[model samples]
Target: MGHVIVGVDEGPEAPTLIAVAAEMAQRHGAPLSAVTVGRDGAEQDGAPWLPDLLLRIREKHPQLQCAGFTLTGTPADEITEAASGARLLVIGSRGLSGISGIVRGSVSQAILEGTSSPVLVVPSRTTSDKHRASG
Candidate 1:
């Protein structure tokens, strides 16, 4: 079965996207793959975080079959390549506004345009949202 792939980044919305992807993978009985893209040798420190992030996600979702990958390239290109043959692709919305916001950020827009698989864009969670929900 094709995996459910999620594009992961250092942004605040990454965990939300990962959770959605993991849930989708569990529902579909497919493995979940998290892909993080950065320039070569530019972010080696960030590579170790993917596994830890996956482990944390697994704690909440024990049944999720999850793996993480770090790649060097354009975020959109790497994400598109990573989701090849996937059942679905999950990404976090960067909350870009104005006319350009019609497509969100460049990476999200590029992935939407280039990926063959279905894409799910999860909105970034904000402190205001938490307060609104609790209030």
Candidate 2:
């Protein structure tokens, strides 16, 4: 199987998607790639938090190897591209209303629609709460 790819996005309510990916990778002993869909950090409230978030995640879960990168285009497209050869694709769902997000969210739905590998969607509320408590 290919490496597990987890797509990171900024969320407001409960976006602790990375935690889910970390757990999975730790359990499966898989190499992890943490990707963000856009350059603006919509996954983390307009903050360039992917690298920092990736670092924090790595610090928390040292068992799983991780790398982080930012995709300069649409979120869903980047995610799909990243997941093309991955054993598992991870993302957060937020009910976006645009062509890209909608298509990609649906694509995520379709990707996991009838397949075997799991697509984990982290909730924003949990992540936000964690962020608040910690920060």
Candidate 3:
């Protein structure tokens, strides 16, 4: 079975993204690969954190196979390349909209345009959103 590829970063949406991707992987009986991209073509601050993140995921979902790595390049390009032939590619949306989303240039949007693989874009969540979900 093709593996599930998840684009990860040190963002507030990361946990949600990883959880969704891991669940998808488990459902598909596929391995999960978490990929992080460094925009400047160098290891980013989150490079060292990827493995630990994967470890936590593995701990939570013991039967799920998980691995993580860092890549240096444009986030969209690198993530799309990594996701080639993947069963699914999962990413978290920054929830940028309107002028801000246009100016910032969304990697998820670019990936949608660039890849044929199925993509899942998880929306960002806020503390208030969490409270509402739990309460």
Which candidate ranks first by lDDT, i.e. highest?
A: 3
Q: Of the candidates numbered 2 and 3, which has the greater lDDT value?
A: 3
lDDT of 1 at 71: 84
Inter-residue clash pairs, candidate 1? none
Candidate scoring better on TM-score of 1 and 3: 3
What TM-score against the true fold does each predicted structure earn? 0.82, 0.65, 0.87
Tens digits of lDDT, candidate 1, 54-104: 998899889878998888988999999989899999997665667777654
Best by TM-score: 3
* Per-residue accuracy of model 2 over 1-135 as CA lDDT, tens digit each: 677788765554213677777777777788888876554444533336666777777789877788877676656666777787677877765544468766645644554554455677654565456668999
- In the range 1-135, model 3's lDDT, one tens digit per residue, is 588999988867777788899999999999999998887755466677677678888998999989887888889999999999999999887767799999999888999999989999887787447668989
For model 3, state the Cα shift of residue 51 in Å.
1.9
Q: Relative to the unseen true structure, what is the C-alpha lDDT of residue 122 in candidate 3, on a scale of 0 to 100?
A: 85
Model 1's TM-score against the true structure = 0.82
lDDT of each: 0.84, 0.67, 0.87
Error of 2 at 134 (Å): 27
Q: Give the Cα-based TM-score of candidate 2 against the true structure.
A: 0.65
Least lDDT summed over 10 consecutive residues: which range in candidate 2? Answer: 38-47
